[model samples]
Target: MSSPVRYAYYSIAASVLTLGLKFGAWTLTGSVGLLSDATESLVNLAAGMLALWALLVAVQPADDGHAYGHGKAEYFSSGAEGVLIIVAAGGIVWAAVGRFLDPQPLDRLGLGLVMALAASAVNWFTARGMLRAARRYDSITLEADARHLMTDVWTSAGLVAGLAVLLVAPPSWAVLDPIIAVVMAANIVVTGVGLVRRSLGGLMDKALPEDEMRAIHEAIRAVAGQGALYHGLRTRKSGPRRFVDFHLLVPGATSVARAHTLCDAVELSIVSRLPGTLVTIHVEPEEEPASFDGHAVGGACAGGGDCGSCPGAAD
Candidate 1:
């Protein structure tokens, strides 16, 4: 397995442990807020397992069926996680509402608070590690998993606060517990929507960022020289890989071998500048001569012929 797969496995194990601890704590305390936290952990458990599967599939080499590779599986995995989070949030809201209508006597508030605080600390460290790994590898699935854990951290913290309020104040303040649960559910819903939006963009094959497109255009132009123009620039990202394809228009007389070499050089340069890039260059003949007036020109041959007095052409 690759490093990404290994990291995902560790994440899944950690999430499972967290789920068990949170559920146990909720059972002991009978706190609605702790139950909400536990429910989110259940979602995290599912998301983490899916992310591990995605990581494994994503790292697989491209085959005949998936010529562009299996990296896009990460997007699907993250999107599913987002949907699960929304569902978990809905469940939390329902539970909180029920508790509001029929408030339960929460016991061992101090113990519940301590357990939640410990869980929060564990989530904080684990989430940070997951995020750092995801950023380093540019793995969207891992990043999404980390975000789920981070949400758990916040919810757990909120649970602690609610428990504290309930313990210090009289029974009249029991409403605070359910209220905090509702607020946490609302936050989770927002995160779920954002994740789903990102997933849709990836699945739709949205164009790469403007800055990335511009950088690629510049890279191609740097090598193609005057009278050469690039078009049909398209780009998309999946997991950690960036897929780029474009058309490069060159002089009609340019040999196939030379054009292939130029494309190779440009691809290499781009890959060096940006990691995990797969480039495809389509060579097209320029139909019209390019103007040189007021624009800086490079490698333009005189007399409109090759092997002549070109400004930057090799002898």
Candidate 2:
């Protein structure tokens, strides 16, 4: 698989290209809407730089001080990008408000529209590639960057369409320039907030998605065999890596070698189902009353009763 840093570099390159194109458009036409588009491309440039740094940090191997690895560094990159996006939106709104109070005639709008369209085309292709890489690598940082680029593309498209309307309408319709800028700002704010929320969730060590959890359960249950049970299943993800820990219950008469073999099998099954997963299994004899003590995810089952009542039974 290609490293995320490669894709991050792709984003940075695209941002630089689009940023120049957009600023050129803004300069040519003196349109607030075009200025708003340029502002977002500036944010994209900063965000891409941050993503590159974060991806470099996140790839570092686990050290003595950080046993879990530096994967959570990715969350910081995405969160910081989100903040930059919102700040850029605020700047756009401020510019739009100024233009609203004192409207100005747009100059050379036809050439400006052409430049904006070219920038949007570059962003559209770059975002698509980044999005595909994100899905393949399960990298949140890449996904955030790609989404922001796509937002910029849409914003540019909207501004182009609105400016086109102004070109044909009366000079009185010049107010649409600021109005379109405000609308574009609102559209990007939504994307910014979404990225912020997702980044926060990742930093908080949120559980894996439902489908991944279901796959884990299926893997465990397949290796558990008849009469054996499991409990206290817990899961979390850090960047592209998933972590799972659980308790496996079996008859007291099961030999130590057999238990070790079963634990190995269960771990293999889970790792197969979800690549890049780290699994820890605690083996406990089912006859032990203390084994059923629920501490994390699964419910406790009192000793000498049917294990079917345990929360893990359903899983």
Model 2 agreement with the true structure over 1-315: per-residue lDDT tens digits: 248899999999999999999999999999999999999999999999999998998888899998999989899999999999999989999999999999999999999999999999999999999999999988999999999999888888888998999788888899999999999989988999998998998998777777887787778777875445676666788888999887788889999999999899989999999999999988888888777644434422222133456644444
Shift in Å, residue 267, candidate 2:
1.3
Clashing pairs in 1: none
Q: Show where candidate 1 strays beyond 4 Å.
A: 225-228, 288-315
Best by lDDT: 2
Model 2 regions more than 4 Å off: 226-228, 296-315
As a whole number from 0 to 100, the lDDT of residue 252 in candidate 2 is 91
Put down candidate 1 lDDT per residue, 30-49, tens digits, no spaces.
98889989899888888988
Model 1, C-alpha of 215: deviation from truth (Å)? 2.3
